[model samples]
Target: MRIISKIKTPGALKSSTSNLLGRFRHDDDGAMSYVAVTGALIMMVFGGIGIDMIHAELKRNKVQNTLDRAVLAAANMDNTMDPEFVVQEYFRAMNMSDALSGVSVDQSLNYKRVTADGNATMPSNFMSLLGVDTLQASGSATAEHGLTKIEISLVLDVSGSMGGNKIVQLRDAAKGFVDLMLPADGSDMVSISVIPYNATVNLGDTVSQYFTLDDVHDYSSCATFETNDFTSTAVDPSTELGRLGHFDPYNSSTSGGEIAKPWCATGQTSAVIAHSSDADVLKAHIDTLNAGGNTAIDLGMKWGAALLDPAARPAVQALSVAGFVAPEHSSRPAAYADSETLKFVVVMTDGQNTTQYDLKPEFKFGMSEVWVDTRGTNTLNDDRFAFRVQDNAGDDSDVYYWLGNSGQGYAMKYQNRPESSAISNGVEPYQMTNAELYSRFSIAAVASEFYYPAYVDGFLTYDDYANAYYGYQATVNGSQADTNLSTVCDSARDNGVVVYAIGVEAPQAGLDAMQDCASSVAHYFDVSGDDLNDTFSSIARSLQMLRLTQ
Candidate 1:
């Protein structure tokens, strides 16, 4: 009965239910604690995943940088290097071989491009719980190279100022530049023309015949341009334009004996080399460039620009036939609009322009001769005032003489001389003063066997004597030379020539000329003696810089 009451009574029942509830609550608390621990573990795993992702991103950045450099080095225009191998070598060098894949290369005449894409997978330190066993990092890089067909004309100043170390430095720097511009293997992609200019631009023996000679003195390779030449941009040899002579300034009377006609003729000619693709040939020619004579910037610029002028096609063609140029480049001095070709001129000078002189004959020799004999008595038989003139005797065997001065009408006398026939001494002589007779004889162009007695008046000055004895034209002074240089430079620029002027330890005149000649002031370089190599290298690198199009 007591056990039944405990099982059935309200107090006993309530107590039993409370005990069950308390047990249930205890179980709930245990389950909640387990859930909190699980949440913390999951959070820790996610945080590790974030850290791994950041590490992978860092690795990707490093790999991309390495690959970028690799592609650039591999895509350079050296001896056709294998792009894939070069990239692989770079990765190996960087100790990132696992990050390289999908490498490719493309090349053309004027451009070379390379692309490399790669990826790396990092073992997961966390996140494996969610099946993210590893993290992938990828990178890609592309690089393009620049190489273009170039036709360059170097108008070098071989003037007296470029004599000692200046020339040596120039030679070394120029040779180095050539080495950089030219491929180790032979290629016609680049052609260079060297024009060493002084008082004149010598087109060499082969290039001289292209012009018609104004004078019979092919003895010199120098020629002065007429005003028309400055106005005209085309250096067309077909125009029959200029006279060819030496650098002799003719003088009939001087401390030394009379200088023969064409006084300035007979000096060393300039050295000119046509366009050549062979670097060795170019360097050899540079070695032969000696320094002498006055500076003629206009002449140098003119000839240099002429070589790049479209009008010079005939000359270029002739050169090609003569084996001075490659046959494939026959169309050189290519049309200005040709995008595939670039024409560049590098003009260097260390000094300013100087006076230029040419020959101008005043008289014709063997045509006539006049002479005065002061020692002889005139027709009046006056002493100390006698004068005589000689003329053609009409007949080869006869001679005619006229004597008078002091305003006394002349008297004509004939003397028979059959041997004087070659002199054309048969004409009647006319009265003339000593000064007048001297002037007449000085102007005679033909060779005459005439003699003159000493006179009191020094009728002709040194310059006059020079002009009369030899055919020196009026002198073109420094100012005129500069004007001419500017003229020719302008013409060249108009024709689309890209000029780069470098002045080494030059004067103000030189600086001005170079500034005017350059395509822009930025293209001009004003360097001291030792900085020449740096300037040259800078230019070479600029020309060789890689151009990335993609």
Candidate 2:
């Protein structure tokens, strides 16, 4: 262990240092160690940058989710709070109030839209080494809750079956629905037409003025629709509608009074209230509904769809001018292609289609063969016999005789023509027109007092008498009514009209028809007891159309 220190000259020292440096550079013993050190430094820098990116992404996701929920809550039409305040509260509850950048809200009486922008900043951990101090996360979202315009046709069944407690419940439910649709604040964006249908739809005087109807009688304002009318959704004002005759076939008493329960419902309250947003007016009309006729679901559905169609715009404008409809809705019932407007029909029925009565073509209007001997009183009673002029086919001679109380034959005979001769005392016979005859007597009364006697007298067969003047003919049967309902419903669906069908304790046939007519299975409601109000509320909620636009 002798440690000896040796010193060399400057030139020798330089040569030795150069030889040692060359050896150090060329040696392979410690090469792997040097590479491991450099690799570790580079991995550390990249791993820190990845961590910073992950933190920024997490913050961005939090901001995006919060903004989305905030905007949606703020856009809700039912939310009465200020939209900006709502959004701030949403972010504050999530402990991210500092991340909210700003909020924007656009609103109207019927619609509300909200947009929210938010951002968050995450301090960089290792990325700062590459000149980055912090990472930024930002997002924006928008949501809207409303339909620009809504047109609803509420077709209600006021048939005989809907009488009693059922009608009372309907009135309450319908009035509640009206209150929901036409808010007290009053938005002109929505208009509702209440069509109450039984055997026929009563047009009322105001609504009937727009249509050209046959001059049969002015007792009631109801039209007889052809089967082809159900194939389309427009009730053309230019088309002439046949007026339903005012005659009661159910009552046969020869009493001198008005015919009870004519085929058409004849009253101001039974008439349709079209394109109105006044809750008071609509509710008042609902209050006066008296049920007495058979069901006509097809007619109700047709009228509901027709009123929503743009083809009825002219009539709506006329109604608006007449002060029946709100002036603001004169341009409503917007075109089917109008994206901003929504058309909906809520058809509710409690029974299936029954027999619909209509007069025969020959009996609808004109002079009749029978003459009334008024006895100078001008009143039609049992004492005032109706004289019939029967023809002898062999000689073509007219034989006039007064109809007797019995259904077999005449009570008396007139030698000369009855119109010219004094039938009783000094009272002359008066030729009765068809209108006068129907107005004076019921169909049953005429058939029993005149036609039945003719059949018994062998002048006419039983079948001919029954077909001629007995009860009214069934112009529309049940099967045909179902077909018509389906046709109109299909037309409505094809035209982009949303149909909501409800069967309130209805029969199987009625339920089936309503289900088939609905826009979807969910749109059809088979409600009973106390379910009507809930079903209507569900429908109202669905109509809100709330969604996020961004």
Compare the candidates by TM-score and give the number of the best one: 2
lDDT per residue as tens, model 2, 146-244: 755889999999998988888887887788788788778886778899999998888887788877688878878888888988999998776888888
| Model 2 stretches with alpha carbons more than 4 Å out | 1-61, 107-111, 123-136, 144-147, 372-385, 391-397, 401-436, 469-471
Each candidate: what lDDT?
A: 0.66, 0.82
lDDT of 1 by residue, 141-253 (tens): 88876646677788888888899998888887777777767766565677777888877677767666555545434554555687657765577767665654342342232
lDDT of 2 at 478: 90
Which RMSD values do the candidates have, in order?
11.5, 5.3
- Ten-residue stretch with the least lDDT total in model 1: 446-455
Once superposed on the true structure, which residue ranges of model 1 sit more than 4 Å away at CA? 1-71, 77-82, 85-102, 106-147, 211-215, 250-268, 361-466, 469-471
Q: lDDT for model 1, on a 0 to 1 scale?
A: 0.66
Q: After TM-score superposition, what is the CA distance of residue 396 in candidate 2 from its true location, in Å?
A: 12
Q: How far is candidate 2 from the true structure (C-alpha RMSD, Å)?
A: 5.3
